[model samples]
Target: MGRLALEVADIFRAHGPAWRQSQQGQLSLDQLKVMSAIEQCRSAALGGHVLCCEACAHTEIAYNSCRNRHCPKCQASAAQRWLEARQDDLVPVEYYHVVFTLPAPISAIAYYNKAVIYGLLFDVAAETLRTIAADPQHLGAQIGMTLVLHTWGSALTHHPHVHGIVPGGGLSPDGERWVACKPGFFLPVRVLSRLFRRRFLEEFDKLHCAGQLQFFGDYAALANTTAFADWLAPLRECDWVVYAKRPFAGPAAVLAYLSRYTHRVAISNRRLVAMDARGVTFRWKDYRAKGRTRYKTMTLSADEFMRRFLLHVLPSGFHRIRHYGLLANAGRRANLAKVRAVLHVAPAIDSTARDLEATVGALPPTFVCPKCGAAMIIIETFTGCRAIRAPPKPRGAP
Candidate 1:
């Protein structure tokens, strides 16, 4: 198990009581379902069949998983499968990881209007990237990218951000040649930031004017146009932060990066430290560190913990992962074929080994029994508190 895995475990152990106690606090019916689903995931509430390793006589019945996106234990395979499918979309060019973050001022409003705001965040960020990169003076190419929305910071705070993995080049309108970005840079971060801010604010104002925004608590007074304008006035003076990282080393690195967040929940099990009575203790990375090794342990009251975790439960039917530009859903296949032709790259091998080789550094559904040095397989699955029959014992186990 890795450090994150441990931290998640700690959070589970510590916050169970608080979560149960504050069931009335602001949880939605869906959030309740997710919590229940995660609790029973892979447990024997939902029936499952069994498979034991042939070599090791170590025998254990595997439980089925809910396979819900919010279930941490189950997202690995989902992310990996998604990554595998996207391999065909690779354009044989440099890839950039760009992050678009929201300011604290907006995050507060976003907390109440999550689905709407998060959706706007995705659209505005994608539009900004596409618009800027397609400018002739910049790159003038129609780039392709995969975008994912993340709603939580390392400390489980409500920080909304978009993480995009984009190919460095794009297809020319004539489809005659690929246009590559500057070797080390893609778009100017500052310019992208300003444009993103303007677009988002414009959409926000439109929503407010149409009475689409709901204001309650301290924000109730801000529902008035004058107050709303006053609230947004300071944001224009502030610099919105949009930045791109150095290009990924290659396609493999890109896949690895995507897996971390593809089906991720607000938190993972590995981050948990200890859970007996004293709220939840977990490790969080302090990203401000120059050495990149700085980490700290935080303990939150169980009620507060659940509140933070639930803040990220997305609205139903929302698409969290999306493709745009050359990798757009419409013509990804033809575009990918052209890209391969241009690079003289062979088509993907139709073998699991090939996918595994491409993503060795990132793995999915790699579960091992902590009690026994054996792999754990799924035998039964449960949706909520219901129980599923346990799998029968292996052929012969004492």
Candidate 2:
């Protein structure tokens, strides 16, 4: 296969050292580690193996992946594995896509308080959905949702938000029937937006009062409780963004959507256009524009590019993807079973054994001969940055 013309790793390998030096004392350990991983990913520094095709004698060298979640190259396999695990969890109902975004002010503070504010975003969003869905005036059912947090916009700027995949309906409070949402609509976005604003601010205030928030730079004054409250006042009245897209066509479409969003990084290598003395150029969406005009390319200096990329390195151990309500891990299986029963549909086949076998057996071999369609077997392995020596000659060498 041909090599990619550009990759985030290429940029990191080319300029990370100088950039890291220039930003000394400012970069976090996590950000530094991400830079290191991306630089070493798929390079000899990480080690690799040699594969030889049995039928054609075609040889190839494959390097190991860094497997860092922040590395763009490493997320594809992770996403696939995650999607496979989620297949059984998919109910037959239509799935709605909802997004809850932080307003600009909160998003600014979230950089320093990522763990706290992001956790609050997930919790408050989930609570808002459950609260509204449980209210008799609304859907009045217990819903399950999977939420994925995206911390960057197309331009690699900090724009924290959660994308939620929710079934079109929920289980009735009595648990005897499925509470299907009105055809084509989930809940009112206006109601969700109003409640999300209130609950998020309420929880945010509690965090401030409890001294869980940290303020830095221009926000240092926010350490004062009164000042923080004053800053948050306008946000209380202004609307928080909460919107629902039209329902996905079916479970298949939902899976396709999740594959694209669930493991996405701040930017993918495919989006990278060029790197040169001018800087790195890449594609970004100008959401305010219409039709084809929305697609745009932007260039940023290498330092700025690396800075923007590292801006999204999440705090250690923070869960960016979360499941709530019926989808909560502890009770997901039972809940899905119940929902299936209520829908009068056959329960999702318990394919644990089959899935395991298929997962192991179904995937095509990683190494294939370029000249012929044949599996390639590893002939040798090497570790670290060591070179791969030629394979040993047969015992009866000429």
Candidate 3:
């Protein structure tokens, strides 16, 4: 895919100032930081590096990236490094993609109480999975789950959902063997749905009672306990969304799956079709529709588009990617060791110093000059926010 001349950065740079002015008193500090980071990312404002090829004298200037998690431009390299670290954690087994979605009513509340609500989303969903799995009627084992929080739907709407990557099996009760679920099936979605709904709604009630949730706009009345309870009454009566998709074919497929969701932003730059006086045009999938009609383009006014994009900006230091159950940080390593032992799986191949060098050595373009195919070496170093005069004209005449 060809890079777009205009990016989300460009949109932010072109229109962000006015948007900020319009919402001067309303935008959160975290949201403002997101706007500024995206606006200045890879631009001259962030400073840059000048790279010169020793072999061909080819030169280029590369700007510094903001490296913000929300930036669409910076996620690729971050995903790659994360994948490398996680490569060793993959057990040779089937994995399932499960989703736990917040109902519309709760989603509305989540907009104002993001940190509290979203944190509970991760906690409650994870507990639901583990609770069901550990019961004797179900799998009766402690499972591992990697949960990712996604707050946007296909249309860039404020649809809050958690996507779970779960291993198809778990360590047995006695810790003696691996207990695998049915080859193609995971937990029952209906059962999962019921439990997830009960746990989250119950926890939400607790949050409200403890004065943790906030309200604004039409939901301002929810700050009162009775109104909040009345509002949540409909939610208790309605079915919550929980789905367990078919198992991934293998480990490689699991990696491919993680790549799509792990570092995803609300929208990628590639989906952007155009930006003009009328509005911004972009592609979206209508999951509710069928056949060719499902995939189509949409246009929104510049202000509205930015509004939707900013809606998904997470609270500062809030983790969207989390590990729980056996994958939880506190005891994950020991748990995985037992798992691999139970399965009799060999130790994962760890890359050595030489192996790392060889891996990098195998890549030609990263080290080679693109123009003349000559190997490039860094001849000098310059710090950011400073001008560098090009390498003394290669010390030769024109």
Q: In order, what lDDT does every prediction score? A: 0.79, 0.93, 0.88
Predictions ranked by TM-score, top down? 2, 3, 1
> Which is better, 1 or 3, measured by TM-score?
3
Candidate 1 per-residue lDDT, tens place, 172-227, comes to 86777788888989889988999999999999999999988888798999899999
Task: Quote the positional error of residue 285 for candidate 1 in Å.
Answer: 1.3
The CA lDDT at 304 in model 1 is 74
- Which regions in candidate 2 have their CA more than 4 angstroms from the true location? 355-362, 386-398
Candidate numbers sorted by lDDT from highest down: 2, 3, 1
- Better candidate number, 2 or 3, judged by TM-score: 2
TM-score of 3: 0.93
RMSD of candidates 1 onward, in order: 8.0, 7.6, 7.8
lDDT of 3 at 389: 72
Superposed by TM-score, candidate 1 places the C-alpha of residue 136 at a distance from the truth, in angstroms, of 1.1
How high is each candidate's TM-score?
A: 0.84, 0.95, 0.93
Q: List the residue pairs that clash in candidate 2.
A: none
Task: Please state the error at residue 197 of candidate 1 in Å.
Answer: 1.0
Top candidate on TM-score is 2
